[model samples]
Target: MGVAWPFADRNEGFREGLELALDEINRQGVLGSRIRLIEKDDKSSVTDGLTIAQAFANNSELTAVIGHRSSAVAVPASKVYDHAGLLLLAPSSTAPGLTAAGVDRVFRLIPDDTQIGSTMAAYAHAKRFNNVAIFYANDEYGRGLANAFEDEAKAVGMQTVDRLTDYKDLNDLRRIVAKWKLLGCDAVFVAEVMPDGAKFVSDLRKAGMKVPVIGGDGLDAAALADTAGGAAEDTVVASIFNPFAANEAVRHFVRSYEDKYNEAPRKWAAQGYDSLKLLAYALEQAGSREPSKLAEALKRTKSWQGASGPHSFDGSGDVRDMPIILKQVKDGAFQYLTEGARANE
Candidate 1:
C-alpha cells in the first residue's frame, strides 16, 4: 500500500480504512489463503511510486496492489504494474488518462477528473465566472484536469484567461497568484491536491485575489477547511461520497468508520474500504492469482454497492456512474450543498 502518510489526515483515512478492510477480509476467509499486506510510503511522488511499483512487480507472490492516492503516482506507476502483469487498483486517483484505451492493468473505483472538470466548468459558467484562470499541479492528474476543464470552459462559452503550473514552492505560488491577479480573472480553478490547493488559495487571499476559487476533489476534504482556515470560506469543490444519503448502507459505513476512527469518514475511507472488498470478490470469482484472470474478473463487475456509491467499471476501467456532490467550506467544515453542484445560484 502506498499513500502520502506525512500529509495530515487526508490520506491517513485511506491507510486506516484499508487496514480495517484487510482485517475483515481476512476474518471472512477471503482470498483462499491468509494474506500478508506490506505497506510502502510513496510520499505521493511519481518517482517514489515508480520505485515502489518496480519492487512490487518483481515480487512473484504479490497478486495485486492497492495504492497510490495521487493520480500523479498512479499514472506512471501503473505502467510498471502493466509491464509486470500485476493488477493495480486505487481508491482515489481520478485522472481520466490513466485508464484510457489499451491500459488494462490499472483500475480505479472513483470517477475521473474529466467529469469533475466539465462539471466545474459548467458550475463556473452557471455562476457567470466568464473569465477564469487555472492553476494546476505539474503532474498527470493536474495536467489531465486542467486540459479537461479548459476544453469544457470553451464549450460552455467561458474563456480561460490564463493557465499556469504550480512550481510547488511558496515563491512560485506567490508569483502565479500575482500573474492571475493582474489578468483580472473572475475566478480561479485549482487542479491540485489538498495541501497544494489549500496553500494556493491561502496565498491568493494573502495577495488579495478574492475571486471565488473553486477546486476539484483534491480540495474536497475537511482538512482543507482546517488547513486553509478562513481562506477556505466560500471555496467549492466536488465530492465522491455523500454523508447525508439516507440509505442504510451508507449510514452503516459512516457509523462503522466513525466508531473505528473516532472521526467522521471522508470519501477516501469509503473508497479504500470498497477497493479491497471488491478485490476480494474478484479474487473469489476468479479463483486464481494470475493477474490476467484477476483483471478480467474485475472488468465483469456490473456494480459494487460501494460505501461511496454504486460503482460500475467501464471498459476503460473508470466508474460508469457516480454522483459528484458539490460542497463548500463553511465555518471550518465541508458542508454538502447539492447534487451536481452549480455555482452560487
Candidate 2:
C-alpha cells in the first residue's frame, strides 16, 4: 500500500485514515498476507507524484497503491501505475478524466467531481439560481468540475455568466469578482481545493460581493472555515457522504471515527476508510494478490456497504448509483442540506 499526499504536514486527515486502515487490516486479517503500507508524500506536486509512483511501481513487493489525494497529482501518477500494471485506489481524487484515462488498474472510492457538480447544479436549479458565475482552478480537478456543473446548469435552463480560471496567484481573484459582478450573476460556484477555495471566498467577500457561493467536494475540509473565516459561513458544498445520514451504518462510522480521533471525520477520512474496505473486499473475494484477478473482483462488487454509503462500480470503473449530499456552511461548519441521487437515475 502507498499513501500519497501533496504536503506531508498538511494532510492530517489522510495520514490518520491511513493509520486506521493499516490497523484495521491487521486486526481483521482481511488479506491473507501481512499487509505493509508504504507512505509517499507527493508534496502536492504532479511531478513528485509521478516520480514516487514510478518508484513504487519498480518495487515488486507492493501489491496495490492506495492514494494520491489531489486529482492533479492522481491524474498523471495514474499513467505511471498503468504502465507498471499496478492497481491504484484513490480515496479522494474526484477529477472526471480519471475514469477514461485508459488505466485499467486505477479506481476511486469517491464519486468524481462531475457527480458533485451535477448535484450542485440540481440544487441550484431547485433554488432558482438561474444565472451563475463560475471560478475554477486551472487544473484537471477544477476544470472537470466546472465543465460538469456548466453542462448540468445549462441542461436546467441556467445561464452561465462568467467562467474564470485561476492558478497560483491570489491577485487574480479580484479580477474574477469584478467579472462576476459585471455579469450580474445570481450565484457563484467555485471549483478548487480547500486552500484555493478559501482564498477565493475570502477575496470575493473582501470585494464586497454578497452572492451565495457554492462549491464541490474540494471545499469540504474543515480548513476552509479557518482560511475563509466569515466568508465561508453559509457557503454550500456538494459531496459523496453526509455524516448526518439516517443510516445506522453511517452513525456507527461517525462514532467510531470520533472515538478514535477525538474529532469529526471529514469526507476525506471517510473515503479513505471506504477505499481500503473496498480493496479488502476485493482481496477477500479474489483470494489472490494477482492484480488482474483483483481488478475483476472489484468490478463484480455489489451492495458493498461503506462508511460513505453502499458502493458498486459501473462499466466505466466508477462508482454507480451513489448519492450526493448538498451541505451548507453554518456557524463555521458544514451542515447537511439535501440528498440527490446519481444523474443516470
Candidate 3:
C-alpha cells in the first residue's frame, strides 16, 4: 500500500487506521505476502501530490496507492495510476469526474460530491425550503457539488435566488447574505471547506441572516463549528457516515480506533480502514497482484461490511444513491437530527 501524507496532523488518524488494517491483513496472510505501506507527503498541494503519485507509479513493489486528500489533487494524480495500471483508492476526494476520466483504475470510498449535492437539495426541499441561495467555493470540489445541487433543487420545485461562487472578501459574503435576505431565501447551502465555509457562515450570522444554513461535507471540519460559534447552531450538514450509529461494526471500529489512538477516529480514518479492508478482500478473492484481476474482483463487491456501513460500488466506481444523513451542530457538538431524519436514519 502507498499512502499520501499531506499534513501529518490531518492524516495521522488515517495513517493509524491504515496501519491497523495493514497489521490485521498481514497477520491473516490474506495477500500470501505481508503487505507493507510506503508513504509520501503531498503537502496537500496539487503539484506535490502529482510528484508523489509519479514516484509511487515507478515503485514496482507497490500494488496500489491509497490517497490524495483533496479533489484538486486526486483528479489529476489518479490519471498517473490509470496509465500505470495501478489501483488508486481515494478515501476522501469526492469530485464528480474522478472515476469518469476514463480511469477504470480509480475508486473512492466516500460518496461523491454529486451525491452530496442531490442529497442537500432533496433535504432542503423536504424541509419546505423553496427558495435557496448557494455559496460554494469556486474549485472543482465545490463547483461540482454546487452544479449537482442546482440541478436537483430546480427539479424539485425549489427556487434558486442566487448561486454565489465569487467572493474574496468578508464584505462580499455580507452583501450576499443581505441579498439572500432581500430575496427571502428560506435556506442557504454552502459547498466549501473551512475556514472559508466557517467564515462565510459566521459572517452571514453577523449580518443577521437567520435563514437555515445547510452545508456539504466540505464544511464538516471541526473548525466550522468553532469559527462559526453560535452561528453553527441549527446549521445542518450532509454526511455519509453517522458517528453515533449503534451498529456493531460502527461501535467496534469506534472502540478499537479510540483504544489504538487514544482518541476518536475521524471520518477519513474509518474510511481509510474500510478502503484497506475492501482492498484486502479483493486481493484475497482475486489471488493476484495484477491490477485488472484485482479490479474485476472489486467490482463484484456487494454490501461489504465496513466501519461506516454496508458499501457497494456502481458501474462508475461510485457508491451511487448511498444513504446521506443530516446532522446539525447543536449547542457545540454535532447532533444527529432525529426529528426529521432520512429513511436510512
* TM-score for each model: 0.87, 0.91, 0.94
> CA lDDT of 345 in candidate 2?
6
lDDT tens digits by residue: candidate 1, 116-218: 8998999999999888999898877888888989999999889898887746566666677777777778999999887878877888787677899898888
> Candidate 1 or 3, higher TM-score?
3
Over 4 Å off in model 1, which ranges?
Answer: 1-10, 166-184, 339-345
Score candidate 1 by lDDT: 0.78
For candidate 3, list the clashing residue pairs, or say none: none
Q: Would you list the clashing residue pairs of candidate 1?
A: none
Q: Model 2, 1-345: lDDT tens per residue?
A: 766775455675666665676677778686556567778788888788888999999999877888787888888888788788888887777887777866787787788877888888988998899789998998888898999999999999999998877534545666666777787788999898878789888888877779899998888777788789998988988777777777876777778788889987777677777777678788999998888788888888887887788888875678866777777777877667765322210
State the lDDT of candidate 3 residue by residue for 180-236, as single tens digits. Answer: 878888899999987888888887887778989998988876677888899888888
- Best candidate, TM-score: 3
Model number with the top lDDT: 3
